[model samples]
Target: MGRYNFKLPDVGEGSAEAELVGWQVEPGDTIVEDQPVVEVMTDKASVEIPSPAAGTVVSVVGAPGEMLAVGSVVLVLEVDGPGNAGDEAAPSVVQPQPETPPAAEPPAGTERTGAPAGEGNYVFKLPDVGEGSAEAELVGWQVEPGDTIVEDQPVVEVMTDKASVEIPSPATGTVVWVKGAPGEMLAVGSDILILQVAGPGNMTAAPVSSEGPSEAPSPAAVAPARATVVPAETPERRAASPATKPGFATRTPGEKPVASPAVRRRAWEHGVQLQFVPGSGPGGRITQDDLDAYVESGGALGTGAPTGRQPKTGTEDVKVIGLRRTIAKRMQDAKRRIPHFSYVEEVDVTDLEALRVTLNAQYAKDRGKLTLLPFLAKAMVRTLPDYPQINARFHDDDGFVRRYDGVHLGIATQTPTGLVVPVVHHAEALTLWECGAEVARLAAAAREGKASRDELSGSTITITSLGALGGLATTPVINYPEVAIVGVNKMIERPVVRGGQIVVRKIMNLSSSFDHRVVDGWDAAEFVQRIRALLETPATLFVED
Candidate 1:
């Protein structure tokens, strides 16, 4: 046997370094030549580095999220013969270190057999997101049972009330058990997965009778039970109910009540103390029905207390997941964090409309039909030079504001999934036709769920419109981190006095919101007025500054 050092090849045009996104193989894993071994992300694209020779992976260099330069030794492997590493190179003999001790190989028959049932298994619990949420819905799992996982790799994506985040694995091991299905809510501190790690793991429990944890308790033991109400008018009648009476048990005077986190949260919300509630679940555990029965028996009723009402028909519970959940979180964060100040201005676009119609008539075949949005985009690009602060991002946590010289415009588009803001990058460099084309392309890509991650992010400012569905005026929410958002309202022909005479003209309203922490009221108003002036004149939009 011999040792070989594998280096990262140049993945891009003259690229010197790449971010180590993740590893595909760990130590002790066997690989073949030309197999992808590691994934690195460059400025242009994400590339997977392949193994140069078939070997057993001995070790990997650098951790995820760190920069690894090209031509650096990324992996060391053990091969069959005299390898590339010369005799003068490091020895094939193992070196001793104090931090991590080497493990003894298992017996011949038990080489690949996982820790007998539940022994040597680490239960990965759901962690508190610190948003005061007691539970999060399992959106999806990246790995399956029996798949190997590494520390700090994303194993699951969970959606909470505040945001959707990926939960990273805490230990390197093989997945032996997974808890909840997608769309099921899992409580904080509840086991989400069980991993079979080397040596004694973080958890020690009773032996299972089956191959895996199939014989273990159901994951629902940690999930919230569904609430079912039975009609009972009096306390005596409630005590007679089967679910509340049979197998029911209560805690001792000093013993704390046993309940899932979901039930505890419900009790706290209704101002019902668990010390007084009876447990009707297995092993003296309190279920959701127990709480309801307690509340019906004249328990403490706070503002969250349910009022008596007639029973209604069946209702469906739709779990919020995926894109809808993301939109909800971002909208909530924008409203909660930004102190918004809105300014509305009316612009007469009769001249601009006439110019647009003439341009379409003259160049309809050569150029695509131009909409008002492209014109509005051009006008904003022209007007942003005088109001640099409006084209900026506010990093509230970092306590800094980044005002950009380039205009990367976010066009709010409505898709079948949800509302998405597809960006038109470097809008200041594009012509009016080019801006329209780019917006159309991005919107199509976003609606089809085919937009790349780079195409959806990095916007200095945003423009939102509802097209003909737009009302008189709207208070647009500034996209979080961006200082300003421009809202385009419905355009209509109305009778108005023009040059002392009542004349009909095409009019539109520009309703915009600015982050009060970064932009003042006077500057916001002046900014809108400048955009209005450029749009209303229609000629100055083409003039060089």
Candidate 2:
């Protein structure tokens, strides 16, 4: 049996490194070709890395939850071929290129030579995949060693923090070498693969070289065609002063710009030259605001005077990371995409509360004791038939709205993992007892992080509550794609006119929001009125279908 060092193949574009989410197979397990062996997660996707050739798992290289660079070795396998009997070492790494200073100006009279059609060796460099993306995880390779590929053929998948992208072959050639295995993170514009082009007769193009001398000039190796001033390393200049050297305004030769990594990332994202962006920092260091102002004003880099913005104090840096990060994105998307109209209506739930208390006294063995939430959910489902817009989803770009026949009620629960909404499917068909039980079950599962993917998604409409901790009103952001959300406020006893007499009534606010794009003010107001009507009469809620 041949020992194969199965490197983790590049899975998708911009994937420099991936978090190993799970493993389908363990060491000593037999696996077949195309069988899923492991699952890796990038910010964009959770992808299953499949086996290329059927083999036995000799070793597993990465642990679950470990972040692995693209092209890193993730497994060792024994292949069936007799030739595989030979021992193979780990995947080879591309030799690091020597850092070169950015030149101020190119030598005059250097003519441009486009892509070569003729034969010879060409080292294909990994091109810049996305803005601000300096490195990416190699997802998988499309061609193997010795495979003949044509120009523009898809070559590999890369995963960036933003998205996954497919890279295409630069020229039609024989694949002689492949670089990096899946899950290995590679820098942009680094040597990734090598190709042997058939030498063309009467060739007009130069052979792309991986090295100097006999090798043809590689375009990637050439510095940017821009005038640059490399600071001279003079004795007088060296001893003169540290501030005199172009440390801030000008970048150090062969060194990265003098800015924080975040500032540098911002510059990259905006396609702004860090050197061109005049720094307003100490000793003229580039700052994030400088880059932002520069890009905002059409490359007017230095014109942005500092606003009265003060640096934050007494603030600890809490990164928006992991599940919390994802929640932020969704909440932001919902608020940004949906034009929400908030409506707060007072509902006298004194009767409803009484009914709940009476029922829970006997509900000791059934539905785990009903609460106001179940009653609210039932009231919503009952009122949805007359006002279906409240129980629907809206796709703005498609201009299509889906009003569901079934109430897949989403219960927004705050958990240790963050705010999670788990769906109770067919909530309309469920009895009051079922709704309460389902809410209890879903809430427990969500809080424990054991809710299934389906349970956490596809919610038609949602209900959020703070229970006893609820305030007078809350304008909750609509859960994305869904048009409405019901927020329950705390019940307060206040003086009210009951039958023309001053009396204390248990009143609560049903603070809710609706997407104005799909739900009109009239429709929204009328819908809440229906809920208020049913909720006020308490008995009407149970009598309705």
Candidate 3:
């Protein structure tokens, strides 16, 4: 009999370090070849290292939460037939060595068995998207297996509590396998897709148990035919009633608490400390319900002390993963990369509001309800012919501006999943009624997380509104490649002087943000003035573009 020293292989991101997250097998646990032995988290993604050969686990080198590097022996196994002795293998197990290229293997704790694929397989694990993200819901896949794809092309969209993310391909190859179905949640370092390439590939995927972990990297477990990707508030995050408030769990000003990644994310969002609230789960494990109960009961709320009757429960830790991570990254990028100039124009929409009411009443029977947004969209599209700068896309890396002849306007819609902007292609070609209908359709699709890639992207410009809840005017951020964004503000009635007479008029503000690099202040203001004029003189709405 011989002993084998299984070292940690490269998880693919150039980094040599990974954090030992969990161990699937302990000392003396008999494991099979390719069985997941431990899970490790890298900077880029999380992965589960499988046993290279079937044998009894002699010793687990590192405990959970320990940092391990590539080439370092993570575990030792006594195989029925092997070369090395156990005593000799155990000494060099913890020694660090040069980093190797990461393989496509599952992280320290993940593998493929569910959603069996066709033909050659190359599984790509999901990465640790920083900011404490662990799992994300499978929003959609951009490419199907058997399709040839170039490197860096987007492959899938995953939704997390923080934001929605578009995961790109790691290499240029043919996709041979895909695991999860739509609306399923995958952990940060589990196998997401399999690409068949000419060179090396990840470990082969084998069938796993029907019941295992849905997100966490567990090789023995396989997801069902359709697994539910519950949002943070699903029954999964539930805690004992009236004990703790999940929504109120905040970031305490001390060491991080012992909460799951999901609960940690929830606590971070609410700005409450985990220590302030109590845990209801086993061994001080905090559940989402406990956090919510604490919130309802008014926990410390950043004070580190619950003045309003602190519940004896505990706090949970949820990782900020998936869609939420994507949102945070994109929002940060837009703000940091682009120079924005905000322009606000107050319009006497008294006439425009009247026109809207009349039109809604007229179309109430056949067409759906109409809001000022449709009018605003029509006005922007019509006015774009006069000022083309606002309706454009800029490629910063290429330093080139792409001006589109057609108006593909993006409407930012918020759903329970996250915020998504659905595009209305050729807005200039549509009538106001058509615009309203298209907006409604796109908004519905986005809210349902069913908007196609084309519907979600390719906007020359964007328009945002908070409806009646729009608190005055807002300075909207430019939608990256798009040079400008127009925001619709709340409409309120106040006294105004038109013909030397103080009278009440429906007033609203058009707040616009433009890329100062492309659009000048004079042009920005004039474009908005034109929108205001079109809305005030509703008769101009019939003008052909």
Give me candidate 1's TM-score against the actual structure: 0.51
**Candidate 3 lDDT tens digits, 1-545:** 87788778876535555655567887788888889877665432336677779888777765433456678667777888754664664744432322222665443434544423443335578766433557767655555545788665657655544333445676767765566654567887766765665544555553343664343343223223112322333222222123445554444332223444445445545644455567776445566788788777766232344568766765544444545566778888899888999999898988887878887888867987888888888888789988887899888899998888899999988865357788999998887788889999988777644465567778999999888789887989888989999998899998999899999998999899999989999999889898889999988988664
Candidate 1 ranges beyond 4 A from true positions? 1-183, 186-312
Candidate 3 ranges beyond 4 A from true positions: 1-319
The prediction achieving the highest lDDT against the true structure is 1
Query: Cα miss at 418, model 1 (Å)?
Result: 1.7
Error of 1 at 103 (Å): 20
lDDT of 2 by residue, 165-263 (tens): 556676777765566655568887666665667763122343333344232223333334111111222221122223222333344322223443334
Tens digits of per-residue lDDT for model 1, 1-545: 98898878876545566656568888899999999998765432346678999999898875543456687677889999988877445423332111222232221112223345544766677776434568987755655566788776667756654234456687888776666655668888766676678767655444433444342232222123212111233222223234342223355422445554345445543435555688776446667788888778664432342578957764434555445666788899999999998999999999999999998898778977888999999998988988888999999999999999999999998875578888999999999888888998988887654565568889999999998998999999999999999999999999999789999999999999999999999999988888888898999999996
**Candidate 2 Cα misplacement greater than 4 A, ranges:** 1-18, 21-61, 67-314
Q: Which is the winner by lDDT between candidate 1 and candidate 2?
A: 1
Model 1's alpha-carbon lDDT is 0.71
After TM-score superposition, the amount by which residue 368's alpha carbon in candidate 1 deviates from its true location, in angstroms, is 1.1
* C-alpha lDDT score of every prediction, in listed order: 0.71, 0.67, 0.68
Error of 3 at 400 (Å): 0.5
